[model samples]
Target chain A: MLHIVNKSPAERNALESCLRVAQGGAILLIEDGVYAATRGNAAENHLRDALSRFKVYALAPDLEARGMGDRVMEGVATVDYGGFVDLVAEHKNCQSWL
Target chain B: MSEGTIKKFMFVNRKAPYGTIYALESLEVVLITAAFDQDVSLVFLDDGVFQLKKGQQTKGIENKNFSPTYRALDGYDIEKLYVEAESLAARGLTEDDLLVDVTVMSRAELGKLMDEMDVVLSF
Candidate 1:
């Protein structure tokens, strides 16, 4: 499954809720959720912790748009929209955490 | 998992507009994905109905009004908009209070429609 979180952890509990129920799948951050990919934000530790159990990915366009492109934590992979479509295809289902 | 397959895509909107960016950004995704030519539909439920509320005065906020774009959705071949009856009633809103024409249905009916979808994206 692909767990898509579109909220910034600073603004909502969507990311936390998603992490709890993710059960070893790919977590794709898009929209404002790309803020979580920043190296030293409040959500960084949680995202780092998630890397051990699940594949973490962020939308490249969103990250660049937010000016956090270079601040992404080490292990989170960045993908374009075409890559996003590919991830959706690879996963059996998707759960969007708003 | 295959390319060239058309899927039923339903975008579930549950938040109010302006207060946050979800509503507008979700609309962005809906417009982008519609180019894929899938079976697309949209549902306005909970505070999301407020997004379509008539007489929005966004001029005070200095944000460019995006509500007008909702009117152009049909041009993208994405028009199956739905409003939850219970949500509308809870908010004391009638279909006449909205900016667009939509089929108002019970939550149960919406659930059935949801079950028929191949993909569900909520914002």
Candidate 2:
């Protein structure tokens, strides 16, 4: 399964909730959810914890929009909209934690 | 994605419309995915039930009302739309309150249906 989080961890607890149920899958951060990739943000530790259990990805356009390209955590892959479609194709299911 | 590559695609809608763009964007993707000829179904739970509410007045907000689009979904051959019964009851909504026809099911039934999907996308 692919888990997508489009909410900022600061404003919503969806990210935390998503991580708890995610056993082994891919995580994609889109929209305002890209803030999770910003280094030293409030959710950095949780994002780091997710890295060990699942492959993490942040939408490239979203990161660039927030000017967070340089600050994204290491090991987290960056992908475009095309990549988003590909991720959906690769995974058996996608759970968007809105 | 290709001809005859049909897969069971489930879209789990859990957000209300207008307050945010999630519901609208999610609908857009559903339309696009349907064009690919995939077997698609939509499950409306929680605030997502609001998406199907009749007589949504978006003119006050200066937004083109898209609620009517749900009525045309069947023309696209995308007809497997389900609403969680408990969610509707919690919101004090009945099938008569919605604009389109949908199968109302229990949470357990919906969960089992979800497990049968090849892909599940939510908003």
Candidate 3:
């Protein structure tokens, strides 16, 4: 499976590009990318439109660092670093965009 | 910067190529990592998108334009190239105008992709 990694403000753009081929891939937001959990970012709407079936995840550390833990969008699950390691084990390949 | 059987590596490039040497430095690391026979991929987003634009005039910046170096990425076996779809459109660019061929995707899809990585490095 293809894993999409978002790491910066441009993550919204990166995420959009990966979703074009996300028919069977998953998306995760980490580091500065967690800002998308806040309201008003076009990223939320893009997710609703492109990855209706894939699970959405955010790095817990990044979310807290941005002070957005409470503001995380609905349906977005929080995962810790260990959980992140689990994901890498599950998927054989990944693609990351900053 | 990874251990174990980390066969696949993903590079999240977020900064512009010229302002700092981060992009160039990362490229060197990537090439060395690939020398270990690891699978490598790169996603250009934010300022990183500016790295691939054609006709970069870095002379006034007193820096060498490394755009040509990208053309050689394939030679290093690091060719899973990608770009942010919205970013390209936001900057009024298309794959045709880029120095490389990249697969574009939506934001949500990119998130999922980042989760399934054996190794991830950001620059």
Candidate 4:
């Protein structure tokens, strides 16, 4: 399964809610949701914990747009738009945590 | 626009850049306001503070890196940039991480400053 989250954890609970229910799948963080994958953010610990259960990915463009491309935490992979499409196609099932 | 017509304009940015259009839209509007010689001040809080962080490279995302425009604000006479102390701390960022020179104030102090604005716009 692939879980997509686009909202900021500081501003919304979409990421938190997704983490609670999602099990053993890949999580792609895009848009404001990319904030969760950065270093020093309050949600860093939660994302770190989720890493054990899922392969977390963040949109490269979104992180760069926020000027945080270099600050992404360790263990999380970054993907471009093409990679995003691939993730959607690779997964038999996907969920967007809008 | 006469000298007496200049108004205090405050643009409150709460969204992270590029997550949505809010941050960019607010910046554009702020530039437009500066052209009118309005007394413009930008307040960055919450994720909005991320807009001011340095080293924003957007080539990979293929979006115009608008973060550089923030540095150009001073040339436009838009120099009053305020950041919330709590917001930076929450994100583990300090003033050193910001691209522009701004006054960092507590939320309470910011609120009082906001009260003095003739107009306040939230993004």
User: Would you list the rank order by DockQ, best first?
Assistant: 2, 3, 1, 4
Residues B5-24 of candidate 2: C-alpha lDDT, one tens digit per residue: 99999888888999998888
RMSD of each: 8.2, 6.0, 5.4, 14.8
Q: How well is each residue in A1-98 modelled by candidate 3, as lDDT tens digits?
A: 54546545443455654555455555677887777655566677766564466777788888888778877777777889997877767777655554
With a 3 Å backbone cut-off (N, CA, C), the pairs that clash in candidate 4 are none
Ranking by TM-score: 2, 3, 1, 4
Question: A46 in model 2: Cα distance from truth in Å?
Answer: 19
RMSD of 2: 6.0
**DockQ for all candidate structures vs. native:** 0.15, 0.25, 0.18, 0.02
Deviating ranges (above 4 Å) for candidate 1? A1-97, B1-3
Taking all chains together, the TM-score of candidate 2 against the true structure is 0.62
Which 10-residue window of candidate 4 chain B scores lowest in summed lDDT?
B111-120
Pick the winner on DockQ between candidates 2 and 3: 2
> Which of 3 and 4 is ahead in lDDT?
4
Native A-B contact fraction in model 4: 0.00
**Model 2: per-residue lDDT, tens digit, A1-98?**
78889989998766775675446678999999999988989999888987888899999999998888888988789999999999989987778887
lDDT of 4 by residue, B13-110 (tens): 86788779888988999999999989999988777899999999988888888998999999999989999897899899999999989999876677
**Which window of ten consecutive residues has the lowest lDDT sum in model 4 chain A?**
A16-25
**TM-score-superior candidate, 3 or 4:** 3
